[model samples]
Target: MKNNKPKYNSIIDAAVQVIAENGYHASQVSKIAKKAGVADGTIYLYFKNKEDILISLFQQKMGQFTEKIEHEIASKQNAKDKLLSMISMHFKQLAADHQLAIVTQLELRQSNKDLRLKINDVLKGYLAIIDDIVEEGQQDGTFRSDLDLRLVRQMIFGTLDETVTNWVMKEQKYDLMKQSKEVHELLVFGLSGNTHP
Candidate 1:
């Protein structure tokens, strides 16, 4: 497919930078094309419109993000360690890339309903990674068997998401990666069945 081509990759990367810098509405196809070092018409060859470019950019980056987390979690022996690794990497990745942080936490949220739906569809793959970890924890007694899988997945995803969004909103004033351990501990404790304070 067109996505497999090198120019498509360039366009996607360019879109990320352009949209991050210009905001989605302010970004023009011409600007993206220029940034990509390709002709304006060439962008059309791979993407239907600016919206398509935005969606594709998210898919590409989020796909890579999920894969990296999956690989990092794979090396850990237990669900708890996997969860910690996922949390740490998620924070580190976003903190390391401020442009990506703005695009994902702010620009991406400004899309219309239909576009947001498509973005959510792309998010399912990343959610599946969390699902696997939650299920593993339940089976291995690391997490409460009584807990709902879907809810736990949401909690984990939402906690990580809100933490990053908060950092972005604060203009990255503090160390985002430093909270990974505390967040991981909070999430793990929530997943546990114990009633102790």
Candidate 2:
């Protein structure tokens, strides 16, 4: 009921911008409310507190993110192509939204342990997408059967996560999308120095 309200999305979007500009610890509910063009009390209607706002922001953004990745990869016939599509979409989405990139890549990491745990819970859906791609690859012989699914998932996610963090730290002066293909290549082939056959 509350989610369907236009202000809910406005609050979420404002939170992203406010959090991106002011670090999560420094961001306040009143500031978010002002940016959302609503009274401070209005934010309380949609969120329990600032922590709830952070979690809800991640949930809303990452939910749309995972859905977009799913839609992008749906038509691909093989795991390799599907993986590439996923990687490209991941980079593209972040690259397109500088505020979101900063909030996710830099700001979110500053939260406390409990908040981090909640954020990790929000990430499972995105991670599961990676797990499925890895499982599909292994089953189809596109990936090495000996690979550990958990490790592979971590490697893929860690690589992408760190790359965006670096881009944000560097003030995003470079073209992140351009590196998608090379990053995909590195993940699929690795540092073995052997070209893909």
Clashes of each: 0, 0
Evaluate all candidate structures by whole-model CA lDDT and list the values in order: 0.91, 0.91
Q: How many angstroms is residue 74 displaced in model 1 relative to the true structure, after the best TM-score fit?
A: 0.8
- Window of ten residues with lowest summed lDDT in model 2: 188-197
Off by over 4 Å in 2: 191-194
**Candidate 1 versus the native: TM-score?**
0.95
Each prediction's RMSD to truth: 1.6, 1.6
Residues 1-197 of candidate 2: C-alpha lDDT, one tens digit per residue: 88899899999999999999988888999999999999999999999999999888999999999999999999999888988899999999999999999999988885399999989999999999999998898888888888878888899999999999999999999999998999989988852223792
Per-residue lDDT tens digits of candidate 1, residues 100-139? 8999999999639999999999999999989998899889
TM-score of each: 0.95, 0.96
Q: Residue 19: error of model 2 in Å?
A: 0.9
